[model samples]
Target: ASARKKKGDSASSTTPPTPTPPTTVVAAPRLSAAAKGDKTDESDKGSDDDNDDNNDETVKAGSESDKDDDD
Candidate 1:
């Protein structure tokens, strides 16, 4: 009976660690999702900066045309 109890205790101990691995597996995907979100945000900022540069160039071109008309 003592040997049987020891075997049961060992099984119980091993079962808890089996659940721990799944928890780590679940957390890994969450971290990867967060990293992807950050990359998307950076790309959006880069696109916005490009739009601002285009707007500035348009304004400069408009001003130059206005100067030619004035002359």
Candidate 2:
């Protein structure tokens, strides 16, 4: 009976505390025109880079076709 009581006490002492649910974290919402403009500006920069790469490929292809025509 003493051993059983000791074992029960140890089990209860070793048990972990109940975990609390994490605080709800929300992203800062964008609601201003300037903030919207900033996003548009960033997107435009990406598209411009893509356009430049595509233009370079098209020019290379055009030059290669011209060389073929010459031959």
Candidate 3:
């Protein structure tokens, strides 16, 4: 019974520290982004613009292919 109680106490102690790590992990990335002069935001916007351009090009290509097929 004493051994079982010790095991239970250890498990509960371990569980509390598990929650702390995630808060630190969440904070770490924001710190890295700030350290890099917040380029993460600019990179994300640039990626979005690239995606838009690719989508437009795909639409144009598809239309051209369709016209070729019709001819």
Ranking by lDDT: 1, 3, 2
Regions more than 4 Å wrong, model 3: 1-40
The residue-by-residue lDDT of candidate 2 on 48-67, one tens digit each, is: 99899999999999999999
Best by lDDT: 1
- What lDDT is reached at residue 62 by model 1? 97
lDDT of 2: 0.74
Would you list the rank order by TM-score, best first?
Answer: 3, 1, 2
Candidate 3 on 1-71: residue-level lDDT in tens?
99999999999999999998998899998898786776766888889999999999999999999999999
TM-score of each: 0.42, 0.40, 0.43
- Name the runs in model 1 displaced over 4 angstroms: 1-9, 43-71
Q: After TM-score superposition, what is the CA distance of residue 10 in candidate 2 from its true location, in Å?
A: 18
What lDDT does candidate 2 reach at residue 5? 100
How far residue 14's Cα lies from its native spot in candidate 3, in Å, is 69
Candidate 2's displacement at residue 30, Å, is 16
RMSD each, Å: 10.5, 8.3, 5.2
Clashes counted in candidate 3 amount to 0
lDDT of 1 by residue, 8-58 (tens): 999999999999999989999999999899988998998999899999999
**lDDT for predicted candidate 1 compared with the true structure:** 0.94
